[model samples]
Target: MSLARTFVGFSSTDINYYRLMTAWKANTNIDFDFVDCQLQNSINSENEVYIKKLCRERIGMASKFIQLIGQDTRHKYKYVRWEAEVAIEKGCTIIGVNLNAARKMEQDTCPPILRDIGAIFIPFSPYIIKYAIENYSMGPEDWYYYGNEIYKGLGYE
Candidate 1:
């Protein structure tokens, strides 16, 4: 099968995780064309508008939207939220991966908008991610959630 065209939504703090996923794509057959929107410096109003337009354009081209839900993600109310909102509006298959879920005892800390919309949340496992990208249906009833554990059609125990 061909790789899914994926747009990754994340904050600067999660750049390492983004890099790791990129490396996974290189080293393994988890085929995906990862797209990112990272700005190095602050921009004025005109530049900001252009960047937002560019981000929306790129996000609109994606088949899947993967959000790296770190603790600070919710606080990044500009780009991350805008990207996710655009993805949701464009009918992209949205998936939230909690970066701290593996070590943290609390529930997955996704953005409030995502959690409110009931977007599927999965662990940061490459196997599960690939499976989700390939198999997760874009229907409300297709997701499997057991209390704090959200399964994206991977049949996890």
Candidate 2:
């Protein structure tokens, strides 16, 4: 099956979790896959304008945007917040993956730009993430999250 073209955003400190997601995509045994819209390499230049330009190019290619929510994600305004803003401006569906494994949006960890904005929040697990990418869509609400039953169906919990 074809993979969804997705742009994922996170704080630089959370790169390891992002790498794990890439590993999930690479593992044939896992049912997760996506055409990652992140920059193939970290931008070496310290120029903010050049960096944002490249990030915009990548985010533009995606129909979905996933934010990896970690402890300090809410405070990072440079790229992570700007990236989410760009994704929203481009009309991409937002999916928040809590690195803490919270199945719902944690107001403490979620970036303010993402709050009350009709984004689906899920745990950082391959099964639930794959299911969200394949089946979930934004609905009109303050925010969205799957119930315990949905998680149970995915063998979570």
- Poorest 10 consecutive residues by lDDT, candidate 2: 133-142
Task: Note the clash tally of each candidate.
Answer: 0, 0
Off by over 4 Å in 1: 29-46, 102-108, 141-157
| C-alpha lDDT of candidate 1 relative to the true structure | 0.70
What C-alpha lDDT do the candidate models reach, one value each?
0.70, 0.92
lDDT of 2 by residue, 103-136 (tens): 8989899998888888999989999998888887
Best by TM-score: 2
On a 0 to 100 scale, what is the lDDT of residue 49 in model 1? 76
Q: Estimate each model's TM-score.
A: 0.75, 0.97
Candidate 2, residue 29: Cα displacement in angstroms equals 1.6
The lDDT of model 2 is 0.92
